[model samples]
Target chain A: MAVDHNVFITEESIEGETAGPLAGRTIAVKDNLSTAGVRTTCGSEMLADYVPPYDATAVTRVTDAGATIVGKANMDEFGMGTTTETSAFGPTRNPADPERVPGGSSGGSAAAVAAGEADLALGSDTGGSVRCPAAFCGVVGIKPTYGLVSRYGLVAYANSLEQIGPIANTVEDAATLLDVIAGPDPHDGTTREAGADSDYAAAADGDVDGMTIGVVTELFDGADERVVETVEAAIADLEARGAETVEVSLPSLEYAVQAYYVIAMSEASSNLARFDGVRYGHRGESDGNWNESFAETREAFGAEVKRRILLGTYALSAGYHDAYYAKAQDARAWIKADFDDAFESVDAIASPTMPVLPFELGESLDDPLRMYLADANTTPVNLANLPAISVPAGTADGLPVGLQLVGPAFGEETIVRAASAVEDAL
Target chain B: MSETPESDADTADTAAAAAAAVDAEEVRHVAELARVNLADDEVDRFAEEFADILDSFAALDEVPETERDEDLINVMRADEVREGLTQEEALANAAETEDGFFKGPKVS
Candidate 1:
């Protein structure tokens, strides 16, 4: 195993119950998830040494289910970047190819699973963090239906768009991990009992026979030629196994990336306001007044985080609120309706998990817009608050390309089964 | 669903506001609003970057007008007191605390 993946920001073995479903398994939790007594840095200097006083509902669920938490994994600072290079600690190298980045902000979680450092790992997906990393690292990741899993204790970044999910080497293993962490938490009011009562692991039975998959052309339009070819081949494989695909169009695709960023940044600006250098975040000298100290102390946040916060502030600013944030919300409504209309005739939607291949280290770091554009295919799913999974479809020019399967809201089982079929077929 | 009024100039102005380039002064102001201190050079750089980002966001103008039905429901529980974090636990991570209260920078 490669030892330099920088997959973990903090490594400590915490053993769970003596016997349960995950007794023999190990997990690498993203640093944003609070683990009691464990330092939970969101890869930002602001919270570099901050440890939570209580366990996040997901952490408690996993530990109670008998899983051993191996460590807090590295991530893009505040779940802000797509390439994981924005992590304040350092970038997590893709285990598949050391020079390339593991897609992030769940990069470290996916890298740990890919490098065999853990049996499974937990990652939070907001605008495709979990699936992007899983795609680049040749693993499976599931971004559950928005309210299926509890988000309590998660370091907030775009609260409405993010969810704590699972990353593992296979669809079944990922589903098994999801089964443990997913459920309604009294702590998080958005959580519902939708997929909590179903057997997600059992649903991954490679049962794509008779499943009707919708191929969203909008998702395919801007993808790399090689990636599109590989995903097409995977769909063909599903057809060989008795599944069928139909071309579908979501006209609102062009606005999704814009809408997603506006909403995410706007939410992030508000969410990150909690780290004002008091009550557990990095503290500064007490020389200045409260607001001054806050500005001075907030300098600990890295460049990408600052960028998001500033833009988010601008989006919510008085003169531009109607122009950006409100319009984005309206676009979100349209995108959700389009998805509902598409799902009326299809069981699931298929696309390339990422529009391009794994980026070389420091490639798009200079151009933030390029990085945002790369998320075109995955952002729509988040906008609609749907469940999607990234399964290793095949290699595109010796680089892994993931096929994304998106299902209806609370439709985890269908996506898991379809993802398992893709896994089996490939 | 309410339609975007075709004759409303205020709506047109709203569409144009996001596409305008944010100057360095505005960037610095926004940084202050966000509570992050940035160097002057950083402020200039952010202005240029924000311009590019805001330009991309101009595409939202084309999203068809529709009444959005966001499915939001309140999850209510019985109004009963539950075990909560104790004062000691709450103050455990505070960098400066006295008399069971967190200390902050002076206001004056």
Candidate 2:
């Protein structure tokens, strides 16, 4: 039997308490997200002993809406890897195949949902973290428009790109979770002011007839044959349902991974700088001065975390600032602009959430480049700050494959509607 | 951005040498800035690994040009001081507190 990776933390059962909206609906939280009084470790030894003082915005919203936090699910240390193998707590195995990895850094959440341990989960999407795992685990995951959900309590990975989103067995369930947590908050300044009142669940059943869908040409060309075949079938299904599929070009799409890594790592380096021994979490045990103690504690962070900090530090380094960091930001603007143009004609863009299915644990664990490339198809949406969802298209060799639908900023309603249609067809 | 030869090398070495360069001292510096502590062996191991991993960053030099007009704007808020947590609530999570302030290990 596959070891259950579900239910990390659960609420004490209250007698006669009818299950809340999420009553009896078990939920798992990604380790990177803060859970008040729970061990939210971000799947790293550095924070193994740390306990958050307050709930993350999503956690508070979900729990308040009657969703129980089963436990902190495993993730890449500080949300860094595409494979959950980087987790200090150990890699979360895919329920489909125990030897294969559950995609990460939201792998645990996806695996929990896949294994039927939880009805739903909350995962942070920073450059496809949520969607990749969902695809690998054959579940539905949504990465809402940037700032759609509050980041006040989310342990920061990349401030501009990361968003708290839902992972569930179906698009409607994911949409339901999004409706509860999507709103403006004083804690997160970047939240969109215009769409604060939108009801995502209500929009799920909206008309898909006559809607224009874009097929990103770049995503399909070099992707795994089986994954592409699955997505192509989804596009065909949409066409049969009266949705028009158009080939839309995002000229700047090629540079997305390059720009995403620079910005994310740069922000991560700065954000993670606050984790030195003095504040919280594990501190180094060295006897030297404050500097040595600080070094010792940091060294304890996983390889992925350290790599990002250094890359970020170097990107922000004085002389190279204009060359690398500034250029990436400019590219980010262009990517956003490309999306704006593409959305002018299309309701949403469809692609395979992941180019390939889940691989065995340790397969890509040592190859960081290969792992980073795993997120290539999904990272562009984050750079454009758009809403996207991964709905299970079909099973390939008994493994789940997700077809991604990406919409313009604040276009959650459209994506949700389209995704719901896709889910129903499957 | 013009690509540098060293940057190309950095991308090629992303998996190996990049992570191998990080050392204990560098980890500590990053930690102090990040506010987390690590044990000594961790520092040494992470330092080497992080260095090897960071080598991929060299590819940033190879990216095409960026728009000069693009600048980051701080999404601003009005300068209004709202009521926040009281002294008691603010100190509630502290390991030690005195006179509504957080108390820490004694400083010389």
Candidate 3:
């Protein structure tokens, strides 16, 4: 059914249980997450033919919950790019509009859900991979707190910032998926018990009475006027439903993009080092020289991936480590403090998920800086290690606009309730 | 280490200086360090793009001096034999293998 959208890298059905919480639901698994006996390419040539010996913990949990596996969804190569165009496979066309790109690196997952190819999808958000595509495709995506979901079987992009999240057509379905996949996994030690046994689906009651939401001024500034207006109208609807909105400022947001990139790329450089063309994946011609072969093998990476790895290597190099990497970490700490301070006064903070609307394919490809800067609003939440949800608020110029709600650490239910309220209004 | 800038303008100045630190040679060197083989065109293009990227990171100069949180938590695991992927499963995806081992490029 989703074959026309270029939304899946591998389109095979895996059988599921007869009955469970997700009975009969179809799920699109992001290529970056491992699925046993299924090809897990991460949309890169190095891994184009690699099949995992094991399933990611999320995959196991979802399958056990009676959700049928629809296919391995396409992604930006190793989850590096914002738009899915960087895939070794071709770009996933946005189901909403074929000309405009589906925001990525989880473009296929969001596109699949938006196209009704799958009932739900799994995506990894290192920066805004999950939420960006979710916003662009006008679907609901949740980037759980850093340790809310297990990352054992995920192809590590950024160890500290990434989490496996869900994308679905509605707040409740996404929350239900979260309930199945959330909680502790022994395979992933980073997972804590905070979200263990979560009843997040029940929390999506669409009731926002007496809730105080912090409308982040920084997130709104510099955003497209149409998107801002659409989000503003959504905020008004929330107010009409009895939720209070206060203008809160996180000035550290000004530094979020740079800090997020420096840290994520640095971590990516380290995490991706395991693809040495030795143990698994693609191999280069030895030519009797090991080092030369290794370097040649890595040539399989696309331009964006190579650029990130190089920049990451530079940031962590001896002469520049302190100036780039360390400073970025300091900014991260400041961002965390800002969120901590904000949460002390308000229940949650809100922003437009993406500053602009769905990008026309090739629009931002030539300018990597423009693509990086576009992640301004979503990256702050990841830097702070907070939970965030992007729910389709409305549309601008016939494209989707998402309102992002951020909650404190382990506050999945709070954001779910807030997002469901938006859904109810819609 | 450079001193923290006193103002936004100073931060911009420092960012420019930092961005200027990169060149074609530096891009090539970093590519080597990253095990990526870039062609001449890529080196030229990346040298230019990397500068723009580093310049945008000027915001780092204004980051408050917060102590790095290095409170490490170790997960203690029982050292015991565990049932894991068999040798066949482990090498199932290898590009080349011999004698039940992953075959590597021959040493020069």
Candidate 4:
């Protein structure tokens, strides 16, 4: 099939699929996820013609639960950037405001759900990719606890941080998709053992009374006024519903983005080594030299991808490994420790998912440092291997602001319960 | 190199020299290791970009060294034989494949 250049990569509708559990529903997949017999580009020219023989566990779950696999959505090349502008394909525009970017690199998945092209979409959240876009697009997105969902077929992007999650219009829909995808899978060894007995959808309606929610003091201090106000209002709504709110500090939060980048890029540099243009996808027609062809093919990758790979390689290089990568790992442990200590006091932590609202498409593309800083508030959850949900709190200057609910590692049940109360209040 | 003999008028020259000290060859070597080919122009471009990036990373030098005491376990599971994909299933979507594995141009 000739791929559509728009948000969807394939347009074929599945026939004979009745309105079952998710019947009459259509879902789009982020391009980085493998969809059997479908072109999974990862928004890279290197994989422009690649197709996967097997489906990602999340994609299979979504389809088997009666949702139609609508298409492969675009993303930042290998999920490296904050804006969809980094996509090898042209950027996906925010359905609400065409001139502005749909926040990335799961921008297309979020936009597809927002634009009503799909009832729901699957996106990988490695840092803020899913949630930030969902916030920008006024949708609900969840990054399940690390190992809650199998990563067996999702294209690797910082393996420890990435999770295939759902993007939907409402918290209930997101929960339903989460129920379908979150579980133990032998295929991915890191999947949590506790995933076997938990049904996320059931936990979505669990009681919220007596639940103590902590407000991360650092998230609000220097954030945009409107963003803080919206999240604060969401907290008020939770308080109205019998949830207690308290202030908590995570001093290490200040260093999360820095630590996140070093570790993510370091892993990315190693993970992306598989796409050398020889074994799969587009092999450059070099002058019959194997090494030269590999080089030529990689040269075809976009600038952002190359930049991340280089940064990662440098961080993981010998001599500097202890200083950068290892130190970042230690910082990850400290960040997790901070979250653990706070969770001991509260059932969950709430914060504004991102400090700033969505900006224009090309606004941060040229400034790499500024772009890296955008994931500041959300990266800690990944570092802690915790479950977090970004639900629409309200709008600020007409753009949505996400109120993030974070819980302890494998504490998805508590987080989901708290999020449901917040959802109900909103 | 005699530390380049610093002088008040030589500040800009010193900065330029510091930037130039970030080897273009090293940048290319890193790029090769990452499996991303760099054009000669990109090598020059990235060398400059990486110099600035490394300058920022130099901040880590200020961080007090910490003990290597992390409880990070490899977290491995007991290896067991399990249900697996058939060779036909495994090779089903390869643009090209051979005897139970993906086939490609020979690597030198």
The TM-score, computed over Cα atoms with residue i paired to residue i, of candidate 2 is 0.85
- What would the per-residue lDDT of candidate 2 be over residues A215-307, giving only the tens digit for each residue? 999888678888898889988888888899999887777767877988999999888877765556666666676655555667777777876
Cα lDDT listed for each candidate: 0.89, 0.77, 0.90, 0.78
Q: Clash pairs of candidate 4?
A: none
Q: How much is the lDDT of residue A335 in candidate 2?
A: 84
Q: Please give the RMSD to the true structure for each candidate, in Å.
A: 3.8, 4.8, 3.6, 4.7
Candidate 3 Cα errors over 4 Å, as ranges: A1-3, B1-15, B70-72
Q: Predictions ranked by DockQ, top down?
A: 1, 3, 4, 2
DockQ, model 1, C-alpha based: 0.50
DockQ winner among the candidates?
A: 1
Q: Looking at model 1 chain A, which ten-residue stretch has the lowest summed lDDT?
A: A277-286
lDDT of 2 at A84: 84
List chain A TM-scores, every candidate, in order: 0.99, 0.95, 0.99, 0.95
After aligning candidate 1 to the native by TM-score, how far in Å is the CA of A250 from where it should be? 0.2
Q: Show pairs that collide, candidate 1.
A: none
- What is candidate 4's lDDT per residue for A170-220, written digit by digit as tens? 777888888888888877878866766566767777368788999999878
How far off is each candidate at the interface, as Cα RMSD in Å? 2.7, 5.9, 4.1, 6.2
Residue B36, candidate 2: Cα error in Å is 10
Each model's DockQ score: 0.50, 0.22, 0.45, 0.27
Model 4 ranges with Cα > 4 A deviation: A1-5, A14-20, A205-207, B1-25, B55-108
